[model samples]
Target: MSVYLFFEKKLPFREKKRKVVRWIQYVIEKEGKKSKRINIITTGDREIIKLNKKFLGRSYRTDVISFPMNGGIEIEGEIYISLDTVTENAIQWGVTTREEWRRVVIHGILHLIGYLDNNRDEQRIMKEKEDYYLERFPE
Candidate 1:
């Protein structure tokens, strides 16, 4: 099982490759799950917007989008994150870019693990979970 990060474009900040991969693996294990692979791709608004339109049929930028590859207990998927959107969101939310990036990444990972934020209540629950994980993430 492995987590790989690809940069489709330059991001506002950089993450230590090993640290990011280890944290993701930690998140999966904490949820009592395993992964075959998780491809976390950082992209600009244009690429992500294209993906949003092509896959989700939404022609707008989004922080993160996840596509689960397998249906069994072991998780496998691709998560595309819009670095541009995430940077803007950080300013909008009054948080650091890194914080917002972590939240978005964790949000995508959670989606891969079957968490949903389709409704207001679900979004709240998801946010709480995200925060919970965020608090424990390595500093």
Candidate 2:
């Protein structure tokens, strides 16, 4: 399995890129998959806002955005993240930068696994899954 990380800013300090890759691997393994390919693109707030509007039809900024390749056996997709949002939320949530970053990473992966957040019930379920993964893979 290959989990590639593409960053617009300097690489994260707290959680190495490889750690996130391993976390993805763990998720795939837990899902009974032998291998899968996932790519992550991290950018600034401006880029994320552009993507949010273009793809999601929302003008506001977002922390993480995911594009799934195909809903099939082998998982493949792209995860776009905003480091700016992560940093801001980290401060707002009283967590470290890496913690918030990891949370977003897990949130994106959960989306790839068919987690939806179009409504309040789905959003709560997705957040629960994110929180569970956060505890599963902690700093």
Candidate 3:
């Protein structure tokens, strides 16, 4: 199992890369999915918009976009995160940028583990899982 993180844009806060990876691993295992490989790419809004358009057929900016590479017991995927959008969302949501970044990361991981948030009920459940994992994250 492996978690790779790439930063395309200058991040506003310092990230404990190893800690984040461990947190993801824990979340995957806790959710009953064995982690195989997960790639996290942090980029700007333009890149995220392009990816969203290319993969999801939507031309817009989002905080996170997840692509499931393999479907099985093992969790494998690419999670693209838009730091620009995260920052904007943090300001609007009254949360710190780091907190918003963590939320986005956890949200992507949840998607890879078979959690869906397309509707209100699913979104609420996903949010609950995100909160559950976030609360357990080592400080």
Candidate 4:
């Protein structure tokens, strides 16, 4: 299992490589999925918006997007996170930027793990899963 972290906008995120990878592994294994390759890229709004338009046909900014690239059992995907949106969401939700960032990261991973939030019920369940994973994450 490998979780690769990359940066484009150089956001002020307090994450270490080892710890973040372990946290990702914990979530994946607990969800009954094995990750062979996972890429987490942190960028700004413009880049994510471009991806949203190109791949998803949405011309708006989003916090994160997950693209599953696996054909077998192992999970392989790319998660693009927009730090600008994450920051704004943190302020809007009255949480620290780091906290919101963590939530978004897990949210993307859950998406790659077959979770959805297209409706109210799915959003609630997804939020509950995020809360469960975040509460159990080792700080």
Candidate 5:
């Protein structure tokens, strides 16, 4: 099991990092995932925007991005998150920043699990799953 965590932008709250990691592990376990090989990277809006343009072909700032390495069921991938967007989205969505961050993490993990956000239906399903796992996350 390999978990790589990279940070580009300072997290708004330092105390919440451990909790976030635990919640991610919980999500993985809830989904019946056994291989704990996952990498999480946090970055600023600029980096995430560049990644969105380079990988997703969209030049916009997004909250999270997932890049799978093998396209297999072993769950080897990279997750890029923008703390700036997470804060802005938290305010826009009327939720706490931590909550929004959890949502983004859940969304990324779902992507690693083969969920696609390219289509309307797929996006809806992914959002539902995100919400479902988020609700089950430990506080």
Candidate 6:
């Protein structure tokens, strides 16, 4: 299993890279799935908005957007995140940027693992899983 993270904007912090990769690996293992490749791209709000409109037909900005490439035994996907949105959300939610960033990354991974937040129940369950994993993530 391999995970790669790319930055399309200024990097947020220097210390969280290893932790983020470890967290992703943990999430995949916890879900009983193996990852062939997982790519995470961190960009700005404008880029994410463009992606949202082009791929999802939504004309608004979002914290994260995921694309699952394969549906077989191994999990393969791309997770796109907007650092601008994440920072804003972190401030709004009274959490550190790193914490909110981790949450968004986990949310994208959950999506690749077949978790959806399209309904209230699914949203609740997804949030539960996020919190569960967040609690165990290393600081």
Could you say which candidate leads in lDDT?
Answer: 6
lDDT of 1 by residue, 1-139 (tens): 7899998877667678888788888989999899998999988899989999999999888989999998568999999998898989999999998999999999999999998999999999899989999998776
Sliding window of 10 residues with minimal summed lDDT for model 4: 9-18
Colliding pairs, model 2: none
Against the correct fold, how does model 2 do in TM-score?
A: 0.88
Q: How many residue pairs clash in each candidate?
A: 0, 0, 0, 0, 0, 0
Error of 4 at 65 (Å): 0.6
Q: On residues 7-115, what C-alpha lDDT tens digit does candidate 5 reach at each position?
A: 7776776545566667777776677664347788888899998999998799889889998766554677889999998999999989988788778878988888778
Model 1 lDDT on a 0 to 1 scale: 0.90
- Candidate 3 residue-wise lDDT, 1-139, digit = tens: 8999999987899878989998998888887789888999999999999999998999899999999888778989999999999999999999999888999999999888888898999999999988888788787
Q: How does candidate 3 fare on TM-score?
A: 0.97
The alpha-carbon lDDT assigned to residue 35 of candidate 2 equals: 38
lDDT of 1 at 80: 93
Clashing residue pairs, backbone N/CA/C < 3 A, model 4: none
* Model 3 bad stretches (over 4 Å): none
How large is the C-alpha RMSD of every model relative to the true structure?
A: 1.0, 1.8, 0.8, 1.1, 2.0, 1.1
- Model 4 bad stretches (over 4 Å): none
> What stretches of model 1 exceed 4 Å from their correct place?
none
TM-scores of all candidate predictions against the true structure: 0.95, 0.88, 0.97, 0.95, 0.85, 0.95
lDDT of 4 by residue, 29-88 (tens): 998999989999999999999999999999999999999987455899999999999999
- Among residues 3 or more apart in sequence or in different chains, the pairs in candidate 1 whose N, CA or C atoms overlap within 3 Å are none
| Global lDDT of each candidate | 0.90, 0.82, 0.91, 0.91, 0.80, 0.92
Per-residue lDDT tens digits for candidate 6, residues 1-139, read 9999998976576647787799899989989999999999999999999999999999999999999998766899999999999999999999988889889999999999889999999999999999999998887
